[model samples]
Target: MKALTIEPLTRDAFAPFGDVIELQGARQIPINLGTTIRYHDLARIDVTDAGGRAIVNLFRGQPRVLPFEVTMLERHPLGSQAFIPLTDKPYLVVVAAAGELDPEAVRAFVTRGWQGVNYAKGVWHHPLIALDDVSDFIVVDRGGEGHNCDEQALPESLWLTSEGLRGAAG
Candidate 1:
């Protein structure tokens, strides 16, 4: 039987694919929790108020990925996206350009996020990967009327196993 080998996920190497938003050192800026913070005098406001609802899709059942097949797939065209791996060990994050999802390029990434994870806009990738375990997360995206989402399952099953990565690395 064939096997797949996993590798480490890096930021600089992944920049060409998309933004690797691994919060290495971002501390919480306390600004009085109860009061609404308004800013009209600031020179530049970096935050855009996109009034949207945060949706949390809980999966009580175990997360399973078939051999050479995708477990969870999702596409977002509007706001930026994120995939926070719930496990402490390394997981997989396969991303590609919009309308440019190649299986070869997708197979190259096997990074991990320890704290939290978030990806920038227009980055195409699988929804969430729990690596060796199942994970649950709150998906924050533009939840409005209109269809700006597309999810495609590959015709052939593609498994990311330990042997597979070692073969590719060689």
Candidate 2:
């Protein structure tokens, strides 16, 4: 199996796959008597074309150890999906561009607790990978009629390592 070195998540690095949901470099608006700072339009919720509705749900994901094996990836052809962590725990994100699975084109990223991601429609990505204990996340995705999800097994399994990601920006 091949190995994928995890890199720190950043908006620029992740732009090809999706949007990185974070307060850093985000548009901020002070509201509610100046008691709260709202990050406006952090991610684009794209479910309009699927004839589906956007739904928010809480996902409690169990942590995974390092050197994890990635055998499969999935994508939503009709809509996009976003995952926002509810706790201060890191997570891993594996992604590839839309189209046939290309092992060499795959990229891995490690995200901080404060960061989230919105996978664009047709972008291939792994399922939620929570780290450092059970983590809760706010997942926003399409819910309703058509089958929006498409999954594919990789040509070969890939191993992902948490190495070289310490203190990296997320």
lDDT: worst 10-residue window of model 2: 161-170
| Candidate 2 collision pairs | none
Residues 70-147, model 1: lDDT tens digits: 533455655555444444544566565566555444443665545333444455677555554666543444554545
Total backbone collisions for each predicted model: 16, 0
Per-model TM-score, in order, reads: 0.59, 0.93
Using lDDT, give the best candidate's number: 2
Q: After superposition, how far is residue 64 of candidate 2 from its true place, in Å?
A: 0.8
Error of 2 at 7 (Å): 0.9
Query: Residue by residue across 1-170, what tens digits does model 2's lDDT show?
Result: 58887888999999998899999999999999999998899998898774788999999999988778999999998888999998888899999998777878999899877899999988999999887799999999999888888889888899876553553454
What TM-score quantifies how close candidate 1 is to the native fold? 0.59
